[model samples]
Target: MTTNNPMRTFDDSRRWATDGTAMLTTAIEQLDASGIAAGSQLPGWTRKHVVGHVAANADALGNLISWAETGIEKRMYASTEQRNADIERAATLPADELLTWYARGATALEGAFDRLTPQQWQHEVITAQGVTRQASDVPWMRAREVFVHAVDLGTGLGFADLPDDFLTALADEIRVKRGLSEDDLRAVSGSLPDVTAWLAGRPHGIADAPELGPWL
Candidate 1:
């Protein structure tokens, strides 16, 4: 999927960020119409919690972008506990406020990315997992946050709700993450619609294989 065009990565990243914000906006609107409360999902967490977490991740990435640009290490948070507390605080906001904050956070992130030079995209940053990765991976990471947590909210939407190109790219990414080869993906092939379901840990056509957990 390489392109001869320069700035392809930047263009793809910008598009991903824009599309992700639109999806989140839609999800929040649906949540409002459905009258779903914050505490609708996992124990001790609500729809607000999920939204807040997504916002927090955007904020973190925004900070990382700033650090990359300035050559100064602006720590995203004091600690993991602080990050979790920030999410909790954001979650306590009213549904309207939380949704608005999520939108603002996404916008802020995109703004940070827009300021980056092409060379800065590949600048190394240490991840929470202690692995170093390119700054360009930030949008993809945030996309996973938005998309997967959208599913966690149990909105009944899955990868199928995304563009087919996005789903195919995501499936390829997941296959690599799960240590599956191209042959493995081909062996269990059915339809493009099933790829999302299979990636989300649902049993589809392949019964003998171990249950696929959430890889994104």
Candidate 2:
């Protein structure tokens, strides 16, 4: 599998963010009118929960971008408790407030990315797990958070809702992330509907499910 080209990755990130924002905006518009208050596909998470998670991720990625620029290693949340607390705090805000915050977070993220110099793109940053990655990985992370969580909201959207190029890129990423050989995926090829389905682990007929869930 080919590693994502930096320029392509950057461009894709922008597209993903733009597309995700559009989806979220539409969802929020409907949600506002319907006053639908319910949990989503993620266990115990309401629509609010999903939006909060996406917004929090945008803020976290913004911080990571700042860290990359400053050459500082930022620690991920100290614990799941802290992480959940933050999400809950954001989720509990008034619906309109939460939506505004969510939009602002994305706008801020774009602003931050716009300011990054070419050299900064190659700068390495260490994740909380201590794994180092290129700064370009930041936007990819943001894209995943926005796009996946948008679907997780149980808003009748799926990977199929994504652009073809985005789906293909995600499929390639999923293959590598899951350590599945191209041959392995090809061997079970008939089972999978598309790259997105394979990425979601809902490959048409593969019954032995992978340990990882659809979150990836």
Candidate 3:
């Protein structure tokens, strides 16, 4: 449902899901030997933490995909505290091991996604936050994780560098997710990148803007 590229079917989201993984992988690999240890845009999170969290998230979403496939109730995480503990534990691994973690988790999730039927994609599953959504949304959720965290790595890629359609859908989603009204959107400039970057709580340099809390 996002990106500059033309996506004409459900199949296309699968493609972007793969593409986003590759994008993040390349960004991580390109980092200097010490870069993965550097701070990310996220507070108190190194690039290692960001990548590790994305890895865990892939596996967590795979649980939802399995739920959709089998009609069983599978929570995204065993518990919120456990989830935090997992990320913290993962963040301490060596950089090469972190890449292994990401590869294994992402590969498994991608394989799980590949097997679902069209009807299965429509199945409802709950998020860690208690939000219920379609199983098909899982791929986009992964895409956002990799793409946004690629930028959060603080190496390079910006909102403008992501696919245009992706940014458009992301901006729209954040607006609704944030419960922003017309007036709220009007508070930012109409530029899609600027608006999305602002909505995402990135450093958009919105002059004299009201301070925004953290965003997803």
Candidate 4:
């Protein structure tokens, strides 16, 4: 059931998930009540909203895992309105309880990953965007969420603090998603983290790069 490419294996997915969660946990741990109430990098949301959103995202991904493993059609959320409402409601939790929710959701997601069989990893699941992809893609999906949202928390962490390999993977994935070719934009280049940030529509003050549209 193993592949010649290690990156495609379940072990590699687990590694990415583990590393991403650790980074997110650290960021969450650093937030104080006042810090949680402060506006985050996200346009109108507070740090509490970002944390709650991340926790909900973990639960959503866990639903996809169940869909793959059980051959049942589990929707990521009931609907977008429900999802937003859930985040807003969760964001009201006290800072300590919010962190506890995040930790619990993350652990449940990891357990879901562990339950996946090799065949289940290849099963198709639909994202909230209605795009269908194999379950194997979930790890990188979660990685992108965690890494990007950690920066969104605005707790002194930035894209620069992410691991180089994660940044590289994120950049490559974003390029594919956005239908970007090297020639599509101005010839902008940087370290992997900076490139990832730029591609995700964060301005890095790198002149000559084409102005990118918002990623989300």
Candidate 5:
């Protein structure tokens, strides 16, 4: 069967994923013990929640990598309940412990990336959202997480600071997700970053940007 995830063919996914991981690592390094307790840009979630989700996501995506490697079905999470529970549990970890998991998870995921054969990259896998996709899209999926969540951590980084290619890709992706046409996106009244934020349902700091929808 063919994979339908739009990012499946983005060859820059792996490199951007690496950059995103490093980007978060830098931000995480700047946060002190008390920093995790602070509120992030994402409503109702603290920095700890954001960090925990990033760490958990690495391990979850690893399951998809394993699925590709062995041609066996491995769900990203055992269950949605289990997924939320895992993030909560990670959130309660000591600052150092959580940081360790953050680093370790990325290491393991990247290791898996290195190990996958060219043939394995074409293997079909399921996303947490239940979409069928090629393993090649896994890095892009991870890229979406680390980069966006890094901003959600309220670390002063914003969409404007993201790599040009990624922002361009993200605007396109979110546009499709929001069911807006190219002209529709063009009609948004702001800079690319602000418009992208509006499309993703984040606060665009504009006077009256239409609330498109929640983050995909």
Candidate 6:
């Protein structure tokens, strides 16, 4: 299927995934009992929900990685309801258990990636969104989830810690997905990270405009 993205390399995606996971893991590790239960920037989602969602997402993406390696159709989740239920169950765990679950899920996905040959990276896989993309997209997709959700956790971590290329690409992608253009919105100005965060519907201390939304 056609995509706006240009050609991407396995090495670039892997590096981003590794760095993003490291950032997310550090943020998750810092959360205390109260901190996890605290409200996150995402309304109605506590830090626990954010953490739970991220962990569950790793498993879902891992399924895609498995599909790529074995040529089997491993769906991301059995169904949307099942996916939500899984995250809810994860959200109930205590902080230590939660961290362990998150770590395992992330590591499992990484291991799957480690096993892929160069040819497998070019294999087509369907995303939860139902869009078909290359296996190479998996690492970048995971990177987006981990990095953006880390910011959603509402700890001190912000978009500034994310790579500049990621932010630029994110801004472009979100603008396209949300049907926004430079002319449609005000001439907003900020650092690349803040702009990316704002565009992605995360909390960013930038010039105010109309609320943009439910960014995944």
Q: lDDT ranking from best to worst?
A: 5, 6, 4, 3, 1, 2
TM-score of 6: 0.92
After TM-score superposition, what is the CA distance of residue 61 in candidate 1 from its true location, in Å?
Answer: 0.6
- Highest lDDT model number: 5
75-176 per-residue lDDT for model 2 (tens digits): 555566877897888667888888888888888888888888777777877664567777777777777676767677777876667667766667667877
Which residue pairs show collisions in model 1? Answer: 38-46, 38-47, 39-46
Give the number of the best model, judged by TM-score. Answer: 5
* Count of clashing residue pairs in every prediction: 3, 1, 7, 0, 0, 0
TM per model? 0.81, 0.81, 0.90, 0.90, 0.94, 0.92
> Which residue pairs come into collision in candidate 2?
191-204
Give lDDT for model 4.
0.82
Query: What is each predicted model's overall lDDT from 0 to 1?
Result: 0.70, 0.69, 0.82, 0.82, 0.85, 0.83
lDDT by residue for model 4 over 31-70, one digit each (tens)? 7789888898988799899999999999999999999999
Error of 5 at 110 (Å): 0.7
lDDT of 3 by residue, 65-150 (tens): 99999999999999989989888987788888888888999899989988998889888899988988888778877887887887
Identify the superior model by TM-score, candidate 4 or candidate 6.
6
TM-score of 3: 0.90
Off by over 4 Å in 6: 1-4, 182-186
If both were scored by lDDT, which would come out higher, candidate 2 or candidate 6? Answer: 6
Local error of candidate 1 at residue 96 (angstroms): 2.6
Worst ten-residue run, lDDT, model 6?
Answer: 1-10
